[model samples]
Target: MHRAPRKKRRWPKILGFTLLGVVILGILAVVFSVQLNNGLRSATGKDTPVDTAVKSQLVRGIEAKKTGDASHDALIDKAAETLQQTPMKTITEAAGNQQKAAELVSQTTGVPEASAQVVTQAIFNDSKFDGVRKAMANGDWVQVYQQGKTLSSDPDIQALTRLVQ
Candidate 1:
């Protein structure tokens, strides 16, 4: 007796193509984000007058933050400036010795060594700061943060305030 013809399976092929399409879209999104970020950096670069022009055209909503005291704001700004200037390599190398790191942070930010240790540890191994490290791996953390009237979602600048407290 002759056997009936078997039906072709299409679900596997359809599923694979759908997955491939999703992956392609995801990659495209990542590339687009990177490109946009790079463009933003060039536009806002410190070395150029473009930054001033661009900033001037935009509405400035974020004023300098004050912790209700002049001395406190000064302390916070000092710590922020220290973190803003320090490179990732310096931070990582200093982290190799917790004491050294704390000393460096204390000297740079003018905070007490004990407070510096806390800030240094947070920068070195805290899970909460992992995102900040990744964003600032290139050492130019300015990309991931904003100071003065700029807006930033990165917790790094905020985290530095812990040093003063």
Candidate 2:
């Protein structure tokens, strides 16, 4: 027996749907690429003024810090000079000397050295030692500390040594 006319297969419908899906994906890709290009352009271009303003502010801040530091150093140097000129013969003189010595230590240790203030404190803190304090006050650190080596056998010194090591 002959067969009736055959119905259309579903393959064409499946193929059409697939093609539509591919076209939609292609459109989305183009749109995404255009958005990315716009974003990059906005990020990089036409921002020269804002960048310059930010740089200028940073430069101003740096300049202000430098000026303040220079002034502070000048004041410290002046104070140190005054303390150094004062003789160290009397107890008061020795006290001032100790202050200068401490300042020297602080200066030698600190990056820029807070000399004047440190020296004043050292002199003010004098009276803790007798002749040795006097020696340090007179800026005889080498002799005074050399003598201190004899006293360095204490547990405090040992503990400090171990901690540093």
Best by TM-score: 1
Could you give candidate 1's per-residue lDDT for residues 1-165 as a string of tens digits? 999999999999999999999999989866575454435655654322333333333212212455568887766566555555553345534645667778877878678988998877876776655544544433233443433223234467657655535
- Each candidate structure's TM-score, on Cα atoms with residue i matched to residue i, is 0.36, 0.26
Query: lDDT tens string, model 2, 90-164?
Result: 222334455545545555345335565654564356443454565444434444556466545657657865674
Error of 2 at 2 (Å): 99
List where candidate 2 sits over 4 angstroms from the true fold. Answer: 1-98, 111-131, 138-146
- The true-versus-predicted C-alpha distance at residue 36 of model 1, in Å, is 17
What C-alpha lDDT values do all the predictions have?
A: 0.55, 0.50
Q: Highest lDDT: which candidate?
A: 1
The residue-level lDDT of candidate 1 at 151 comes to 25
